[model samples]
Target: MGIIDAHHHVWDLSVRDQDWITGPQLAPLRRDFPLSDLEPQARAASVDRTILVQTITVPEETPELLALAAESDLVAGVVGWIDLTASDVAEKLGRLRALPGGEWLRGIRHQVQGEPDPWWLTRPEVLRGLRTVADAELVYEVVALPHQLPAAVSAARHLPELTFVLDHLGKPPIVSGQLKPWSAAVRELASQPNTVCKLSGMVTEADWHEWTVDALRPYADTVLDAFGPQRLMFGSDWPVCTLAAGYAEVVDATGVLLAGLSPDEQAAVWTDTAERVYGADRPNQCRIRRVSPRGDASLD
Candidate 1:
């Protein structure tokens, strides 16, 4: 059986600055983590296909990722960034779609958690960009901390047609082993059919030095309950997760988290949901080494 890692990042250290990794808590991730270091880990875990996500919101990074996806057979899709608040969002999105491996580009993401504005999603310009996203048939990757859950929830309700993927399960309170407000917001967010949850980035939220599957179960259980198997998909935050656990460990933790789900439910969470969300342009096949049409670059 194969797994599709729905979330991961690859960046060149020689490229533009990634200031976020310089912070004290994130010091472990200070170096460049390119695709070179990622291939072996993906192979070890049987992750035949992966979606290459952009690490920064800068305009150039999206095109760079698309270029990588163009060259790498393992990159089945890409969730690139776009400044959703820009006035010419539609034009910008159109340009991204016109780039090389543009077809590999599948979604939009913003660093909502980094924004000083707690109500960042409510910005008029941001909604304008989201409207453009729906028009372009792209998905939205929701990256937010626990405090930003309400903003994400609000965006989901306002743009019912847009496909929104909640990253890292909204970075729930796994470290403290509590699931109150996190569970509440997740349930509310999942109540909207257009929203889906990615079981990614759990390691960064847990006690990295002392994390365990038992500590992650409650959070995972809520996502499975709220989104169900049909709306859930697995993700390994990759190099970033490496700060706490290895790629195999992240994959195994997801396996442990979903042990009790039925076979069909397990299949859906592992493979089906991502196909339904980011895969309208292609067929859904589990264990595919690479998408068909078999081009080194996206011919779409």
Candidate 2:
């Protein structure tokens, strides 16, 4: 089956330092991770297309990602960072779209998880900026912590026109093994037709040295039941996922978590859902050829 990794990131440390990779735990990510480093691993896992997501919240990062996507065969879409609360956010988005390879800009994102205020997404100016994103026909990716999910749900309810893609299942409390508040909050977010969730980043949330597919099953099953496969997409969250598991391991673990679904349902999670949610139109946006499981080649 074809696969579209809906969330992955690449960074060049030589260009600028990643301020977040400060402590010993994140030291592995301090070095540069260009698309050249990721291409082979993704190809080995049969990932036909990928959505290149933003790592840091900087004005220059989006344009850089767009230009990189313009030259890549695997990066089909880009979910870049934007100042959601900027008064001139609309004009800024327009300018980004006009830059080289800007047509690949499918969505916008912010590190809402790092915000001191749990309700940051519900702020008035942020809401206005989100409306502008919708007006531009772009999706908004929410990288929020579990405590911030309520605000994410509130924002989704406030703007039905904008598609909200929840990254990493709102960073569930897998390590602690608690599911009550997170599960309930996820259900509420899925209740909004405009929202979708990514099945990713769970490995790092668990014990990096001892996490099993079963440990991730509870949280995975929670979203599967809440959002259904059509509203859930698979993402390697690569490079970051390498902190806990390899690229193939993440893909295999997700496969096991989704083993109970029908073939069609699995297909939705693997590729179709992402293509629809991220607007990855094969004819116009992506031109990568598909390599079948049995070594046959076909146009994507």
Task: Residues 1-300, candidate 2: write the lDDT tens digits.
Answer: 469999999988889888999888988888988899889988998897999999998899999999998898898899988899999999998999899879999889999999999999999999999999888778899999988999999999899778788999999989989998899999999887778889999999998889999999999999999888888899999899988999999999999999999998999899988887766754224321221222122222
Window of ten residues with lowest summed lDDT in model 2: 287-296
Global lDDT of each model? 0.80, 0.87
TM-score of 1: 0.91
How close is every model to the real structure, measured as TM-score? 0.91, 0.93
How far is 144's C-alpha from truth in model 1 (Å)? 1.0
All-Cα superposition RMSD per candidate: 5.9, 5.8
Q: After superposition, how far is residue 20 of candidate 1 from its true place, in Å?
A: 0.5
The lDDT leader among the candidates is 2
- Stretches of candidate 1 off by over 4 Å are 280-300
RMSD of 1: 5.9
